[model samples]
Target: MKHWIHNKLAKVPAGIVIAALATAWALGAVLNEHGMARQDRHEVVRMTEKMKTVCVGRFLLDLPKEAQITFSTPRIDGFTVVIFPETLDEFQTRLAEREALIKAKPDRLGGDRNLEVAKEVRGDGGMTGKLLVHSRAVKEGTASNGLEIERYRHEGVAVEALMHGNGVSVNLASDFYFPDMVGNVLKLAVKLVPNPENKVPAEPGFCMDGAYLRDPLTADQLEQITMFARLPSNPDIRFLLILAAGLQPDKDGLIERDAATKSQFSPTERMRFSRLRAAPRTIGGIYGEEVVKRVHELNDSIVYSFWWEVAGTTDNIFVPHIVFQMDTGEGDHGPVPSSLSEGAAMGMWDRISSSIRVRPTQPPERVAAESPPTPLGSYAWAGERCPESGWWQCSDGGNGIGVLGGQRQYIRKGERMPQALLLPPQTLWEKLRGVQPSFESKTQTSWKLVDKRSRKRVPSPLPLAQATPVAAAGITSAGTGPSVMEQQGVAVGSFAATGLPCPASGWWLCDDPRALDGTRWFARGSLLPPATFALPPGGFSRSANSAKSIERRGAWRLVRLADAPEQAASDDNGKLA
Candidate 1:
């Protein structure tokens, strides 16, 4: 039967066949064009000057505030980006009822020869659904035994789920892909939350539904919305705004240049196309290319179109391809001149497109996470318990005059104050003499508290001093071979200068007779910081009482050894060091 039909067709002339095919194609194209919805020439376009903030997906943008907005759902995979003009509570309640209705239906796997239920998934945000995989058994080349060999073709899988977040809900579905595209799309939906109160995790992720969610697809995803103007006067005039973001078309579809590519059109088609403007433009910090065109249809109708698109790639969640498009034509038809003037459409496009921007996403800190305050300027002395938890500044400048890290340390409350390294007198002299001095010594020092309100506690620096102290060996004078007292063989009444390392562990008496702390325990090798005096109940202003008013520099005389009987006697007077 096939040979007989082919023999009959081979007798027909090639020119006649070509003409018939061309006629059919031309007839179809003409019918399709005529059947399309046309713009009503009488209807005029109008717009309000007021604008409002519209939150769609994870982004926020300004729209005509007074423009009536109606929500519609388009079949989009991976994400459902939409703006519900209703209150969050209202939307949630309605969404819950819809979910309940779906749940009431009995589950039954349909008996189909070519389709099978691969798996079912249930999760939060109404993510309860099943995946369907397409399969078909086909007979292949026969085997040597004269038996037919059968093979199965796995034609991918598909899934759909309801995702709830950001005050609205949408049904998320995915197109069929070999490696369980349904599961991947569901994973993205499961991570979606309505206004998430958590930090955005590192990438292979994106912000959606007012929260950051992991996007399993390595490919860039795009979503778009077509906003139609409601003009009662010109009901048929189609003036709509199209806003889209994320992935965009490459060279084809809406992204292709219409007027510039007239070379691809016939002479008659080229006569009806005109390019008004095409250039690089920047809106809301996003660099994108723009194009404006006028289309003159064969039916004597005119249409205006505008397009702006940003360049982007995968893994760039922060910088997605933002598209702002406007058209004055019928929805189904290619383009038609609308009652709205081209000038007004351009003005509206500029006003709305310039306002496109990524919404600010700042994670808020919980009030309970804040730490207790540590008053600055609170002072603690060496060998005494720290009064507060915070960074403390030591009065003793460690040997090198003003070293960076050594002068400050973070200390917690109730911890014993460790001594600071003393700045040797000889070291100071060397510095005064324009010479660099180096030394390491620990001496009892006064510490002033400092803190940041945002940080509850400051971390301690690298090993400065031991938590437990061992018996100290004798101290040598700074830059000097030996102290005069050490040479004279006197263990008691040894002199130690302020800001200098202590030569011995003993009860050191302040040389100043009127000082509040007459004598204090000194650990050998600890720096002898200036003696401190208790200030009034209310701390004096810095202008009224300088740092000298609270602390004074004076020589310290080792009155008694720390392990001696006299040293124990000093502790009996409630002065434990």
Candidate 2:
């Protein structure tokens, strides 16, 4: 009985221990849940109150991999360009200095702790956001003892600094490229407007073409956008400048021929025009030339290629060409634009550099076979022989081979047979017919306008005369005189009736039959509405209006129609009746 009592006591102790452990586990879980809830709440509050400001910084420095650089100049108002260092140690020092500077000038920096953290954080997207740096490097070759010892090449690099609002957003991004020269920095001031809640990414005051432009201004209305170009940056990148301009036709058709010819337009307008013209052609030409020169200097095999587009009012057409010129006898090839086949250009590049290999991603697997065998025999393979059923063959014979016994067979019984073949299926002989692969045939030619003074070539604008009208009826015509109706505007319409001859130099005016109650009128003027007028078997011209009579000149005769009162007096005096 004593032993049994001892056993029961042992069981009781074990049960008590298990209960205590369960209670402790439950308490620990509750504490963990509470801590997580608090963290989530904090994050939500921080993001909700965050104010976003886009800062763009241009730095003339070599960027080291994974380097964290910061800028803390008081002069920087809206945007900031933080220069990255080439070495790890330099980056560290710069980062430390930036922190000290920020702490020193907290008021100028503003009250956003999240933004501050972003500015201070390191690593990709850690604090400030992602870093987009552009660089261009040029090296020169050297010649010794009457021989070329070394030639130095010039390179430019551009970098974009992006800062986030909540320290968690994808930082601003920019298109980066290498410049042709060194130590050149372009700075711009931009204003940004944030949403009412201020939690969203700061948007620029104006809608520009690309995201690289700076954004989101403060109440003081200050913002700065900066860009840097240096060597070691990607060469394929490009910058797009969005410009707005008032285009007015030259009334006199005379370009100013004076010393201050450039001042014909306002400074703003001139700058805008220059940027628009330069953005595509100038930048590309300058950079491409620099790249070629640099490659030559290094004695490395280099090739140059270029492709461009001629954008019409209706459609964008591509003109592609490849020029292979090499520095070290390594021949240059193409500067193909994106409009051309990227595969073809890459193939050319591969030929120049055998070490280069292009592995194209597998084409998407066809989800469904192309338009299942057309029921009407219009399908691409409809005329081919059906391997499964030897009986079903095109009228041209087996697989449209058009050979052997000339027995024409189409559909047999109720079974559908192949129809006529539109084109012969590609064969090995067809592919091998051209040894050169017709590369030059792919070349395209387009017309471009060249500025006389600048000697710059730009895609030409379509002429008004060559422009096809939208409506077939033709544009409306304005009156001969400068009436309000003429001034208001006239639509160009059909020219079926007006037998008026085409003008020699300036424009001619004519009224449509619809407007003149089936009567055609012709007049001479610089501007008039468009219409058709009926002429005599020959052509005619009208004289200016006079006080007495209306005179009409035609190939047939010169006739004058006088008032009716004069004719009435002649008849009354004939017989005194």
Candidate 3:
């Protein structure tokens, strides 16, 4: 019967048979590519594997071993870069030290003591989702160089990635990277297809792509939020987002102010899309606000990730948060659907968030003895409230005028956190001097920084002042060492001629006689009388203080910095005033 059938079928058209075979091959390819069941099966297999776990004092997470791990230090003003121990024993030892340090003084420097203790505290509500961040330009880049990979794993699967951290502040940025796998992760890219009418600027990464996160998500806010790179050539593939988790002050509502800030969206997208509601969610029993807002237009293929840390016991503590954002498009134009559905994406998020458990991670056995803390940078206050002010201090600008990490920023007056810019606090040390943070310079100048280690940094002649001892040391205006006032083109001659007005940490501020407002930095108690008139700060030979007081011009007030007196004075007669 088979032979007869074959003989009869041999008369059939060869073209028809060939077309049938080709059609079957094509159909099989499409099914394998888009088949969702096969993908779900892969997910089950991934879940079956052991999950790698890491602890943050209060919260614990069990992520896939195959996923990369990066843990950073927490920050108050900006993102902190933490250093992870390379060896297992080192990891355990370092974590133990971190826990002890917070418990030791909580407010070791002048940072928010409450925030320091937040991580150890547990959340009252249930768990939420998985994510990561790249929120602001905190300049954590300082610690990014030559970073060591922090590894973790439960089963055979393991992932390795760099971790940036600082020891000063509690805030940090943790970045997680996962290798491209068919079952679990997807890669996404953002691109600019030059418009036929206008040309896209050739600027590298300067586009207003991610800066919109810095502002409030007000009513119908359209911000130019793009992914890291320009859209890839093939738009069919899914776009994946990297996760960044960190801490920020819970400003009650969405970091909102009275007025609406400006928008930052691209012209092609035109407008942004958003949907916000009180989705009071629970994560690891921590009750926090679930603020879900889209900072992009619906027409644009993108996914937004945002989370907040559960409220803690004190106002000083900042909450932890997760921010994940990605854009996917079906074609060069139109709203591109994410490869992961809303529900699937949420589950992926929950897979991470729900895994948070309040437990301690086992550190390496017989952890190494803790190393003494190293002082790296020099920081001065600029604004009114120091970091110790807790929620009250406005970080809108930096702390009153501060200097560290190779950049000069405004820091709070009286605010001193030498370790705050830990993207490797050493970055600042390297900035002032060479690699030796504790090294001292013998140069006699007004621009020098003397750390507690007796190490001093004196750069070449510049506008900045040299390091001065906190003691009420006299500034010999007649001598060679120029005073800080002189360098600024102004002079603060002591009327008493007994001692200089500003101490090492003391700053001379322009004051108003009527309101008594000026750039003065006085400690709690000082013998120096408040001079109604202060000579303007500059190298000018003689200039009168801008004051209405009858006291004759050039008669300036001298106030001792009671707190500063404790700081060791440099061997070189460094001058602040």
Q: Give the range where candidate 2 is weakest over 10 consecutive residues by summed lDDT.
A: 441-450
State each model's CA lDDT, in order: 0.52, 0.27, 0.32
Give per-model TM-scores. 0.39, 0.19, 0.25
- Residue 269 lDDT in model 2? 43
Give the Å shift of residue 445 in candidate 3.
31
- Once fitted onto the true fold, the runs of candidate 2 whose alpha carbons sit more than 4 angstroms away are 2-7, 10-14, 41-45, 48-444, 447-509, 513-577
lDDT of 3 by residue, 1-577 (tens): 9998887788576767898999999999889766765675455445426666543322345555554433323221122223222444444465556445534542324444312111111111111111111111111222323577544442111111111112111112322222121101100001111111111222221112111011111111111111122123323323222222232334654323211222343454434545433365666665555544444545545654444344333221212333222233344565555554443444444566566544433443554585333221221222222322111111111223222332222232245433222122347758777663332111100111222222222232212222233343344322223354345443343332112343222433323353232334333212233334323445344445433232222222433222233332222212221
Give the alpha carbon lDDT tens digit for every residue of 1-577 in model 1. Answer: 8898887777566668898999999999988665431221111123444556654433455665454544344323444544233455665576567445444443333333333332333334333333333332222353454575655455443344444444444455543454424334545545444444333333333444333444343434554444444444334343344434456435543335544477788898887877777788877676778887778867777877778776654455555545556666654554455656565556656666777776665454567866454455545667788877766666556333543344666577789987654434455677789864444322224566644222322122211122112223345434322254355474776677777666665567788876555666666666777765555544655555333336667788876554321211111112211
Cα RMSD to the true fold for all candidates: 26.6, 33.5, 26.5
- Which portions of model 3 show Cα errors greater than 4 Å? 1-50, 73-249, 255-278, 293-337, 360-577
**C-alpha lDDT of candidate 2 relative to the true structure:** 0.27
Q: Regarding TM-score, does 2 or 3 come out ahead? A: 3
**Stretch of 10 with least lDDT, candidate 1:** 568-577
Top candidate when judged by lDDT against the true structure: 1
